[model samples]
Target: MTLNRRIFMIQSLLGTVSLTVGDQAHTEIPVLFEDDSQARNLGYKEDSRKVDTAKFPKYSAGQKCAECQWFKALPEGSTGTCGVFSGKRVNRNGWCKSFVHKE
Candidate 1:
């Protein structure tokens, strides 16, 4: 009886730990990096101010992800989901060629 109880308890502990780790992995959205292939193609800059205007003439001062139509601001943190980057989070101050004013 004692051995059975110990086995059950150990299994329960392992199950709980596994669930917690899995939940965290699923719930966390990965942050988009400027060096990412897709990001580089789109001229994504983590900070709009860092964007190279000579290379991307369409970019203008004050343009940022937070003000763009593709961005969905999260309840917490400076990072938010961008329609341009599926399953990835972008900095609120980030900029990309896909930017469009949120009307």
Candidate 2:
């Protein structure tokens, strides 16, 4: 079988990145802080109860990162990965304007 040129180039690039990053790629993802600029921009609150409804009119009483479609909780923590904040963990109880309820 002949290798497609595009596929070969993609594979080579991925291999290079994997080798270059090595173990560093597996290092723990940092937790997103409430004061983080990205979080502030999105109005993220570590505790859903602490959200200022008057400031964020879109937020509802029950919304949280754990309930958002973009969140993926780790097996053993109160934090999870969020699509809104790539490479960082958000508190499961966190609230952000970007929240989209999981179906």
Candidate 3:
């Protein structure tokens, strides 16, 4: 076999293994800190009930990240990714101004 062919086959195998292993060992998303700039801007609170009612009058007692359209619900944790904050995670019970009800 050519040297280039061997290299390609090895790379493909490594890529496949990486993906498989990654899927089996999914890491929990870290909880978003309320102090985070974006969180602050969105008035995100770890507990939706704690959201500043004065600042965000639209927020209701029942609003939650787990039910928000922007939230990417994690399979096994109380934290998940939000479309508004790409790299950071938000608590499933958290609330933010940008929340939209999931259809």
| lDDT leader | 1
Query: Residue by residue across 1-103, what tens digits does model 2's lDDT show?
Result: 7899999999999999988787454247898998899999999999999999999999999899999999998856688889999999889999999999999
- Better candidate number, 1 or 3, judged by lDDT: 1
Q: What TM-score, computed on C-alpha atoms, does each candidate reach?
A: 0.74, 0.73, 0.74
lDDT of 3 by residue, 29-86 (tens): 4567999887888788999988878889999889999999999877667778899888
Candidate 1 global CA lDDT score: 0.92
Which ten-residue region of model 3 has the weakest summed lDDT?
22-31
lDDT per residue, candidate 1, 41-83, as tens digits?
9999999999999999999999999999999887576988899
All candidates in order of lDDT, best leading: 1, 2, 3
Q: Which 10-residue window of candidate 1 scores lowest in summed lDDT?
A: 19-28
The 10-residue segment of model 2 with minimum total lDDT is 19-28
Error at 64, model 1, angstroms: 0.3
Candidates in order have lDDT scores of: 0.92, 0.90, 0.84
